[model samples]
Target: MKEQFAVDVLICGAGAAGLMLAIDLARRGISFRLIEKAAQPFHGSRGKGIQPRTQEIFEDIGILDRIVAAGGVYPPERLYHNDGSYSDADVMERGKPTSAEPYHLPLMVPQFLTERVMRERLMELGQIPEFSCELVDFVQDADGVTAQLAGKGGEETLRVRWLVGADGGRSLVRHSLGIGFPGKTLGVRALVVDAVITGLSRDYWHRFNDGDMTRQISLCPLAGTHLFQIQGPVPLEGDIELTAEALTTLVAQRTGRDDIQVQSLSWTSLYTMNARLADHYRMDRVFLVGDAAHIHPPTGGQGLNTSVQDAYNLGWKLAAVIQGAPEALLDSYEQERRPVAASMLGLATRLLEAQKHGNMRRGREVHQLDIGYPESTLSQEQPERLDGLSAGDRAPDALIRGAAGHPSRLFNLYKGPHWTLLGYGLDRDAVPSRAGLHIHTFGPHGDVIDEQGHFYEAYEPAMGDWILVRPDGYVGAIVTHENLHALERYLLQVGLGVPGVFNG
Candidate 1:
C-alpha cells in the first residue's frame, strides 16, 4: 500500500471531521487517506459537549459505547444568574432522556476525548493519519485532485478523486484555494485553563450573567478526571499575560470552589472565536467541512459536535461518489450541511449577542429553539410522519430493539456509514433498495445489542410505523412505499443510495 499512489479520497486536518470522514469511509470499504499537520494527535480538551444527534452518529460508527465508557457524556448543565440558580436542563432540550431507548440522553465528553475516540476508531478501521505531513497545497482538475504533501523528506504529491478540507478554521486548504470565509470576530476572549482538581465543583457547567456582564464556567467529566474552563466578557484587546493565577481566581469566584486544589494544570490558553461560514462549502473539485467551512463561539458548545455531524453527512456522499453512485450525491453535501452550519452559526451569533445584551432574557430566548433538521428525501418514504417525529431537523430519541431481537434504541443503529432503516410498517421486511444501507427492523421496543448478538426486544407504537435513516442518524424518509416514485426522486437527488438493485 506504499507508493506514489492514487486514492479515492484525501482528507486534510485529521481532527474531528477528518477522522470521522475517514472512519465512515473505511466502514463502507472505501479507499482513502487522512493527513494531519501535527506531529501527533491532539490530546488537549477543547470543545466540551456532544448533542444527542451526534451521539447517534458515534454509536453508528461502533464507538459510542467506548465514548460513553470514556465518560464523554457531559452531565446536564446547571445554570445561574449572577445571583440565583435557574435550570439544570440542557438549555437545548437534550437534557432529559426518555425511558425507552438505549441512549435517551446526550453525553458531555471533552473535545479531546472525542478526538481520541474518533482517531482510535479510524485506526480500528485501518487508516492512520499521516502526521507531520501537511497539505502544502492541492491541485484540482475536471477529473481529480492532486494534493502536495510535505514532511521531513521535502515534498511529494498524491492524486485522489476528491479533496476535502477538515483542517481547521484557519484552513490552509481553504487559503490555498483562495476561498473567502465570511463572519465577524467577537473581540471577546475566552480564558481557558484545564487542571486536575482534588474537590471540583459539583455542577456540570455554569454561567454567571445578570443584567450587564457574563462569565461562563464549565466542568467536563471524563472517566475519572475533570477538565474545567472559565469564560467571561473580556475586552477585545485581551492580553495573553493573564495566565493560570488569573483564571484560577475566576473559577474560584464563580464555582465557590475555593477549597478545591488544582493538583496538576493540564493546559491553558485564551481562544477568541468568530461566528462565520465559508461563502461556499465547495469550490469545484475541492470541498470543505467542519471549522474550515464555519466557526462559531463556544456558547452552546457546538463546535466539535457540528464538525463531526458534518463528516457524517459528507462521508456517505463521498463514498457514493467513489462507488460510482452519482455526482449529484456530492452536490447535496453542501446543500444539506451548509444549512446546518448556518443554523449553528445563528445560535452562536444570537448567544454572543445575548451576552452583549447583558441579560438572561435574550440568552434564554435564543437557547430554546430545538436546533435540528428534517429527513432527506433520498432514502425513506415517510415525510409527514418523519416531520411529526423531528425527521431531518435533529433526530428524536426512542427505545426499540436491535437486529438480534433484544432491547435497543433507534439511535444505536447509527454506528456505521450506512443508512439506518427502521421498519415498522406492514412491509416490515421491505427496506430501501440501496446496497450499502444499514437497515434494522424493530418489532416494537426497537432492538438491543450486547456482546452476544443483535435482536428485537419490544415495541413503541407511538413512533412512526416505518422509517429510513441517513448516515448522520436522521430520518431519510418514511414509507409504506406510497407514491414510490417520490422515493426514486429522493434517491436521484441524494445520489449513491441505489433506489433499487438495478441502479447499483
Candidate 2:
C-alpha cells in the first residue's frame, strides 16, 4: 500500500532552531508544519548573542539586514567593586571586518526579538508556526513517519516524510524517541530576568561582584528595548521568589546600591546550567536539532547560535532528499553537525569555568568563524592542495566585477538555494553546468573579474582549480582538471548531479 503524507517535514518547536528550519524550508518551497506547545512566541530575553557565523547564515537566509537593524554590538562591561569603585573592561575581544570575514563582532539581540524577525520572515514566505500544538507521540517506519499531534481542537494524526525535534532541553519528541541525553547537571543556579530597571545607564553592561565569582550579578541592557536582562546567583539554601519585588531586593542587596531598582519584570526564571549531548541525532526518519541534540551552559553565547546553524545544516539536506535526492544526503547531516556540537559544548563548558575563576574574557573562539567539517565524508580535497582553504572549510567572501562592470560579492552570488561552483582560471565551457548549480569563472577574460585579486588571494587556486561549495556555505570539494571526473562522481554521490548526465 502506498503511504499518504500530510507534509514533507513536521517541525516540533517554534524557537530559533525550529523557526530557522521553517524559514529555510519555506524559502525552498518545501511543505512543512512548525508547531509549538506554547500559545505565543518565546518572550524572554534569553540567548541574546548572535555570533558572527550565525550572522553569515542570517545573511544567506535574507534576514541579516533586519537582524542588524534590530540588534546592536556588545557593549563594554562596567564592573563595580564592593568598595564603591568601578572599572571598565572589554566585553569580548573585538575584531575588524575583512573582505573574507565581513561580520566580525557578535550582535546583541534578545531571543524574543530574534524569534520575531524569523517569524516575520516565515510569514512573508507564507507559513506561520502552529502554536499550542504539541506532538504527543510519533511512530516512524521505513516509508515515512506517523505523528500524533495534540492541539486546541483535539488529537490529530499527521503523516510526514521526516520528523524534526527542535524542542528545547525537555524535548517531548526526543524523550518520546527514547534517545538518551546523558550528561551531568552543574551545581550552578542563577535567576535570569527581563526587567525594567531604573538608575542604570544603558551605555554599558553593568556587573556587580564582591570579588567572589559565585556572588556575581549582572544587568545588561537589552538591545532594541528599554529593558535590562538581570542575572543574579540563587542562594543554595533558600527558595527565592521570582517576582519583580524579589528581583528588586536582590539587585539592591547584591549591588549595595539604593539607586538601582528593578521597576518591573516581564519574565524571570531560575536557570540551572547543564551540559548534555544526545546519544544519537537521528533515529530512522526522526531527527534531533538544537537543544534537543545538545545543551550547553550560558557561556560564550554559543547555544542559540549553534542551534540556528544546526537547522541551517539540516534544512538544505531535508529539502534535497524530499526533491528526489538520495536519502544518503540526509545521513551527512548527523555525521557533520554532531561533531561541531560536541566541540562547541566543550568550549562553552570551559568558558563557564573561566567565568567562575573571575576570567570573563571572550575571544575569537566564541565567534565560531573557525568551525568546519574537514573530517566529514562530504569534504574532499587533494592532499597536496590542503595548505590553504581546503575542502570543508567555510567559503570566504571576496569582491568581484561582473561582466557588465558591476560590483558584487562571492557571498551575494551564493545567496540563493543552490550549489555554487567557482571555476578559478578555468574556461567557462570547462565549468560543469547543472540546473541547480550556479557557476562563475574568475580570472582574465572570465565571467567575472577578481578585480583586486581578493578571490585569488583568498582561495589561492592554481590555473585550473575548481571549488564546489555546499548549500550551507562550506567547501564541498576542490579538484583540478586532471581529477575533474572526481567532482562529477562526488556530486552524483551527494545527489547533486543528475544520473547518467555529464555537463563537462
Candidate 3:
C-alpha cells in the first residue's frame, strides 16, 4: 500500500541546491517537499570554500549571519619545497567591506556546517526536509510531475506542479529523462579525508608538492573545529587500505615529515575529476540543478557555490510561475544557467591544468562576483550609452538616507522576494504602487536621499531614468522616461506582470 501527497514543487535531494530551493519556495508561500536519500545530513568538509557572491546570496536569504559566525577567513598557504625549503603565499586576498560589496572574501566553513545552518533557517521558516527519502521514479506531463518515493515509513506517491533534481552527479532524475551528460574524465583520483592530525600548525594551509606537481598533499585546518580537511592525489597502481594507518603512512611519505601522525579519521572519500554538463538543464516540466547539471574539479572551489547560485536563480522564477506568471518563463532557466555552468566548467578545468603546471595560487576570478547574464533574453536595455551596469547585471548596493531620517541601504530595499522600481531623480509620487513591486525615490525631498552620492554614481540614472530589479537582484529593465506604461510592458515581457497591471 502507498500513501499520496501533493506540493507545488518536489525537490529530489537535500544538498545545498535542493535545500536553498526549498527555503526560497517556502518564503514565497509556495508549497514544496524536500527529500534526501541519506538518513542524516552529510558529515564532511567536502566543498569548504563559500565564495563572496554566494555569501551575499546567503545574506539575502537570512542565513548569512549564522554562516559568518560558524566560519572564518581563508588562511594563507605554506608551500613545502622538495629541496627542504619553504615559503608562504596568500591563497586568498582579503578586502574591507564596502557599500558596493559587503562580502569581500571567500569564507571557510565546513560543508557540513553550512548545511546545518541552512537546515536551521528552514526550520525557522516552518519547513523541514525529510531525510532517508529516495525518489525511485518520476514521470511528467503537460500539467505536472508524478513521482514515486520510498522513505523510512513506506512508499508514497507525490504529485507536484514541478520537479527539481538537485541530486549529485549520478542523478537518477537526469538519467531517467535520457539527458546526455557529455564531458571527459580528467583521470586524477583524489583521496579526501577529515581527521585529527598531529605535527601540523593550524596557522596556514600546509601543502606538499613534488617538483612536477603530479603528486601533492594538503592539510587545511577547518575553522571552528579541531579537524583538518586533507586531500592528495592517489597513484593509479597502488594498493592502500582506506584506514587510519594507511592514510598516516601516505601523508608522512608524501610530505617527508616523520612526526606528523594521523591521530584519527572521522570521514573519507575518493573522488575522480569529471567535468561534465547535462546536455540540457530543463527537460519539459522537470529541471536539473547543481551537480545534476554540471560537475567541476575542486581546483577553484566552485562546485558548491555554483550549485547554490543555481538554486537562487531558479527559486524566485519557480515562485513567480506558480503565481500565475507565464509558463514560458521557465524556458529562461536553461537559457541563462546552462551557459554559466559551461563557463564554470571551463574555468575550473583551466585551473586544474594550471595546477598541474605548478601554479597553485587561486586567483581573483574564482570569487565569482562578476558572473552575470548580460545577454539574457529577460534583460532589456534602451539604446543609450548603457555604461557601468546595464540590464542583466547584478544591482550594486548604495547608502542612502530614508524618509524616517535614518541611514538605509539599497540592498535593504531589495532584500525581499519582490521586484523593485528605483526612481533616481523623481518625485515621491512619481514611483507608482504595484503588487509584487517595491517603489523607492532617491533624490532631495523624496523617500530617500542619496546623501553620499553613491547611488547616483553607481547607477548614473538620467533625470527620468527608472531601473527595475528582479527578485534575484539582477537589473531586469532600464527605462529612461517617466513612462509607467513602458515599465508595465517590461514587466510583462519578463512574465512579471499581467495584461494591465504589474503582478505585485
Candidate 4:
C-alpha cells in the first residue's frame, strides 16, 4: 500500500525560523504544519537587534511597518566608571538610508515582540501554530517522512513530504538524525533578565564595569516597553539563584549603587556563549534550519536575523520543488546558507571575544547587507561578465516610474512569490511571458521608465541585458538579449516550465 501524506511539510519549533518558513509556505499556498513544544509564546528580550537586511525581508513579507512601530533604534551606550563618571559612546555606527538600501540601522525589537509579529502574520494567513505539540520521533525514506507527535490530545502519527527542524540549539530533530554539531564553548557565562528598575535614565544603555570583563553589567531599555534587560557575568565560583532578590543584589554589588533597584522581574535566563555548526544541514527528507543547523554567541545580534534568512532562503526553494521545480533546487539551500551561517558564526565569535576585551563598537559588517550566494550553483552569469552586479548577488532596489506614471520601487515589482525578469533596452513585446514569471522592460519605450536613472545607477545594465531574479530576490542569471535562449534553458533546468505540475 502507498504511504499516506497529511501535509507537504512538517515544521518543528515555531521560533523565528519555523515561523518564517510557515509564513512563506502559507503565502505560497503550500500545505504545512507548524508545531512548537512550548505552550506559550516566548516572552524574553533575547536577540533584540533586527538587522537592516532582516528589515528588508520584513518589508517584503508586509510586516516592516509593524516591526518599525514596535521597535526603535539602538540607544547610545553610557559607560559608568568607578569614580562615578559616565561617558556616552555610540554602540553602532548609524548610516543614512540610500535608494539601494532603505533600512540602514538595526532596529531594537525584542525577540518576543518579533515572534509575536510573525505569529500574528501567520494567523492572518489562516494557520495557527500547534503549541505544546512536540515531534517525538520521525523516520524518513525516499518518498516522505513519517513523524510521531505528542500533544495534549495524545500521541498521533502523520506523514509529510518534507520534515524541517527549526527547533533551537538543543534540537531533537537534529539529534535524531545523528548529525554531529562540533564546536567549542567560550569561558564566559552571563545572567540575563528583564525587569522594571528605577534610578537609571531610559535614554541610554547603561553599562557598569571597573576595567574587568567578568565584572561587566549592562542594562538596556527594551524598546516599546518599560522593562530593561539586565545582563551580568555569572561568577564561576558561586551558585547564583535566578530570582528578583538575587538580581537586585547583583545590580547593587556590581554598580555599588543602592538607588538602582530591580523592583520586578519578568524574564530571566543564564546565557552561555558557544559556537557550533551542524556537520550536515540535510539528511534524506529531513532538513535542519536556524539554530538547529548552527548556533553561536549573540554578540553581533546575528542569531535571529540569520535564522530568519535561512528560512527565507529555503522557503521559496521548497515551494518551487513542491510545485514542479527540480529536486536539485533544494540542494542549494545547504550549499548557499551553510557557508553564510559559518561566516556569521565566525563574526559572532569574534565579536564575543572583542566584548570580553572591552571593544564593544559594532561596525557595518554586522548589518548583514553584504551577504550573498556569490558562489552558489544557482548564481549564473556570462563568462565575460566581470565587474558589474554579478549573478548570485542581491538584486538592489531602485525607484522607477510605472506605465501609469506612478512612482514605485523595484522591490514592489519583486514582492510576490514569482520570478521577475528585467529586460534592459529591450522591446516590451520581445520578452516572453509565462505563468509564475513577471517580465518588465526598461528603456525610452517600456513598461516602467527609469525616470531618474536610479535603476541604471543600481544595476548598471548594458543595452539588451536580461537579468533573471529568483523568487527569493537574488540574481539567478544574467545574459544578453542575443542569448535569451540561455535564460529559457536555465529556467527549464530549474523546473519552471509547466504550470500547476508538481513533478516531485
Each candidate's lDDT (Cα)?
0.65, 0.88, 0.85, 0.89
Q: Compared with the true structure, what per-residue lDDT tens digits does model 1 show for residues 128-242?
A: 8888988887788888888889986889888888898999989998888888888888776666666665554545555544334444555444433555554455545636544
**Models ranked on TM-score:** 4, 2, 3, 1
TM-score (C-alpha, index-matched) for candidate 1: 0.79
The digit string of per-residue lDDT tens for model 4 on 1-504 reads: 966679999999999999999999999999999999999888999989999999988988889999999989899999998899989989989789888888789999999999999999999999999999999998888899999999999999999999999999999999999999999887778888999999899999999993476678999999988999998778655677877787888889889898898889999898777899999999978999999999998899999999999999999889888887889888898999999999999999988878877778898999998888989989887644878788988888998989889999999999977888899989866755667788899977788989898899988899999998887888999999888777777887677655434322
TM-score of each: 0.79, 0.97, 0.96, 0.97
Best by lDDT: 4
Residue-by-residue lDDT tens digits, candidate 3, 91-132 = 877678778777778899999999999999999999999999
Q: Which stretches of candidate 2 lie over 4 Å from their true place?
A: 499-504
Flag regions of model 3 displaced more than 4 Å.
1-5, 210-214, 237-239, 498-504
Global lDDT of model 4: 0.89
Q: List the residue pairs that clash in candidate 2.
A: none
Q: Give residue 155's lDDT in candidate 4 (0 to 100).
A: 99
Q: Which ten residues in a row have the lowest lDDT in candidate 4?
A: 495-504
